[model samples]
Target: MKVSIKREFDFIEYEVDMSDATLLEILHEIKTNQENSLAYSSGCRSSVCGSCAVRVNEKEVLACSYKVQDGDRVEPLKNVEIIRDLVVNMDKALETNARAKSWLAEFNKETVLNHEDEKINALQSDCILCGSCYSACPVYAVNEEFLGPFSLTGVWKYVSDKRELNAAQKIETIQTNGVWDCTLCNECTLVCPQGISSKADIEKLRMKSSMAGYSDPNFGQSFGGGFGFDGTPSF
Candidate 1:
């Protein structure tokens, strides 16, 4: 099978013969047999670490989990700087998380949580920070300042916590460069390996922002206002 990889150096194609193998397996085979210098990143091959994320046919997926196909066009995750062959620099995602302050702010460690809230939090907390949603996001492509799906979803997780009293502040953080920027494309929801719906989480954030008195920045404006050249107001 022949696979094309878009590396930082150039577009390099490799051939590998393997049956019932994952994409990362083929990559490792290429590195071991064909080219000794091929570079990629992977850990916890069980899809828990989320370090083996890449784009197969322009869609983000976990290389370690996705089955390899013949004539596949494999590439590094988009909206990021490629560090090597399949590896990308995740510094931007890390920086965004810090800026969003995805962690819980004030909480008494002594407080015990009930089962219901814990269950809800667990659903959002299972995120592995794979950057798949970040890579799959279209908003980040045009606007780098916008907080991508994973970051916003992380914010939602914290903001929804029963222990959180600063929901208003967190919602404010998401209103700018966060929820408003999302096109609600649902790409992040489809590609998540953990079954987390970043789109839905972001929508919830948008609703919360509206309740917080933050409206869409362009709620009333149109392309050329509501007036036509005939002096008639256009709807």
Candidate 2:
């Protein structure tokens, strides 16, 4: 099997006699035996920590879970600053959560746990912060200010939290580079290792925003004329 690893200046390929091995194992073998300068990130090797994320053949996947194949091209996650080899600086993508204030606001401490709220936010809470969705998100590439999928999913989680007391402010924060900025390409959902649907979470956030009396700002750009802000087509 031949594995191609993207480096700072170019791509390097290594041939190994192997089959049915995980990419992380292959990377370790390559680093230990072949190249001593290979760099990548992994933790919890069980796919729970989400640190073993990388692009296998241009598709985002968890290295711990994804099996290696013959002639596989491995690259770092896109839309992030690469520090070395497959290791990328994830701070830019993670900063969106702090900027968007996706964390839970001052909520009622005495609020009782709601099963329905737990059910609603269960999937969003499963995010391991691997940043695969952010890499797949085109909006994050073009608009750095645009909150990426994981952060948006975080916002949606807090919005649906029974203890949250500041839902209105959260809604306001996402209006600009938040939900409306998403292209709805579903790439984030496709690349998620946790099977958490950030796309669905964003959709729920949009619906929540609509309930809060907000709409997509660029809605009329498609219609140009005779269309309304409410998105109703006029004869």
Candidate 3:
């Protein structure tokens, strides 16, 4: 199989003997046998650890989980600093996750949730923080600080927590670069290996926002509005 890895300055192509192999396996093979300097990141070979996310044909995918094929254009995830071939600096992604306070920050220690809430949060809690959503995000292409899908999904998880005290603060934190900014394009959902639909989760957050009396920041300042043909009811 032949694949190309994006270097800082150029694309490097390699041919390996494996007919059916995972991208990670091919990467390791190339690194071990072909180029000792080849670098990539991986923790759990399974999809549980998101550390091995990269772009295959301009689409974000977990390298360990994605099957490699001929003429695959392998590259590092977008909107992140490339540390080396197919490796990116994920430290900022982790920091944003923390800054979003994706976890419960101030729930009563003794409080317990019902089974439904627990089940929902548990499904959300499977996030491996792999940053595949960040790479798949279109918002990141324009605004780097726009807390990408993973962080927003995390926010949604906690915002839905039964013991949460300040859902308002969580909503507000997500209002600007968080949920409202998402184009709802479903790109993040398509790429997530965990099968967690960050886009759908974000839409839920938007519904929660509307219930909270929050509106889009760009609500009524467009050309269509000034022309008196805006979509709003003529109240």
- Candidate that would win on lDDT: 2
lDDT of all predictions, in order shown? 0.82, 0.88, 0.83
Best by TM-score: 2
Candidate 1 has what TM-score? 0.90
Q: CA shift at 90, candidate 3, in angstroms? A: 1.3
Error at 72, model 2, angstroms:
0.4
Candidate 3's TM-score: 0.90
Which residue window of length 10 is worst by lDDT in model 3? Answer: 226-235
| Per-residue error (Å), model 2, residue 210 | 1.4
Error of 2 at 28 (Å): 0.5
For 118-214, candidate 3 gives per-residue lDDT tens digits of 8976767888888888888888878988888889889989998978888778887777677777899998889888888998899999888877766
RMSD (Cα, Å) for all candidates, in order, is 5.3, 3.3, 3.7
Q: How would you order the candidates by lDDT, starting with the best?
A: 2, 3, 1
> What does the lDDT come to for candidate 1?
0.82
Worst 10 residues of 2 by lDDT: 225-234
